[model samples]
Target: MNLAMKISDHDVLLVIDVQNDFCTGGALAVPGGEKVVPAVNRIAQKFANVVLTQDWHPEDHVSFAPNHPGKQPFQTIELDYGIQVLWPTHCVKGTAGAEFHRDLDIARANLVVRKGFRRGIDSYSALFENDKRTPTGLLGYLRERELKTVFVTGLALDFCVRFSAEDARKAGFEVAVIEDACRGIDLGGTVAATHQSFRDLGISVVGLEAFL
Candidate 1:
């Protein structure tokens, strides 16, 4: 839909967590996760402003299942912020899994915002950590640059991409998720739920063709 939609200078493409850990043959790969790379690369060329978000966690990060006794990846646990899905130990800082996917083309990205770096908090949204109170400086950065809209794409449609798009909309930016340029973890029907949430929040779910 909206094939005529055009990217403007005031819009920024926010690429989320296309890191090694979320790709094929990695620590916490989303199914068919690496498939999004081509779509992302193709659409990214259409944008003048781009921001890339990385999940940079520590070995002892609270979100990792290994950090919590008797916990497994994808298990839910209550944290100080709220319920967080325990994830496999992934994206450890300075590890290969923490690096961007080798096939990703980041030539157009002007900013790379790393999140979930704090050992105690898990950050899913690019604008804020899991607590929803701590700022990641992304909102102010976007505001200062006068970027009024955000087009999101990347790994795990049900988690990081979903949170980032929702937060962007909540922060008063026009937000859209490039559906074809994303893959979902789809844990416990989360993909369907995420689409519903996007609709409720007025976040557009658009195809990559919108940018093409």
Candidate 2:
């Protein structure tokens, strides 16, 4: 695990969904989510290009458990795209939960991509919505900016961070995940499964020291 990679201008640091809802004392908190803030802040300083992602869902978003009768949070239901995990009502637009974590330093970020805002669709990846067809415009933004590699970090490693890394690879960009700068929901062995997926996708899982 000798990651002696240099931080170049062609690389971008993608901080994904480090919002209040995913942190402590919010609607849908991931364990130790707030702990990522410091790690992300420190690593972000090494990158010249930074992009932040936010999960800004509508109140009646399809992924919410309350939107589906008799379904509970963490339950899975089939949608037009595929299986959708129901979440607690969280990160509603214009709400405090949708805002970035208070301790997350975003001053260096040049772009902020907001996803999951559509009432009928859910977006887990910064590059694409959950449907895998609907573009979030991030891929184009990166391409236009000539960013050849993407270093991802932030909340819920099993979901958003994992999906973002995969999509970034699928879109032909080199991708890596800063493991220590992320937290996970870890529903039913998802953390282990995500690691397997990352291996299969050729996504590097490095620690904060990779940048330090």
Scored by Cα lDDT, where does model 1 land? 0.92
Looking at model 1, report the run of 10 residues with the lowest lDDT sum.
Answer: 1-10
Clashing pairs in 1: none
Per-residue C-alpha lDDT of model 1 across residues 76-125, encoded as one tens digit per residue: 99877789899999999999999999889987899999999999999999
**Model 2, residue 70: what's the lDDT?**
96
Alpha carbon lDDT of residue 107, candidate 1?
79
Query: For each candidate, what TM-score against the reference?
Result: 0.97, 0.98
Estimate, for each residue in 1-212, the C-alpha lDDT of model 2 and write its tens digit. 36776888999999999999898899999999999999999998889999999999888999999999999999999999999999999999999999998888989899999999999999999989988999999999999999998999998899999999999998899889999999999999999999999999899899887777
CA lDDT of every candidate: 0.92, 0.93
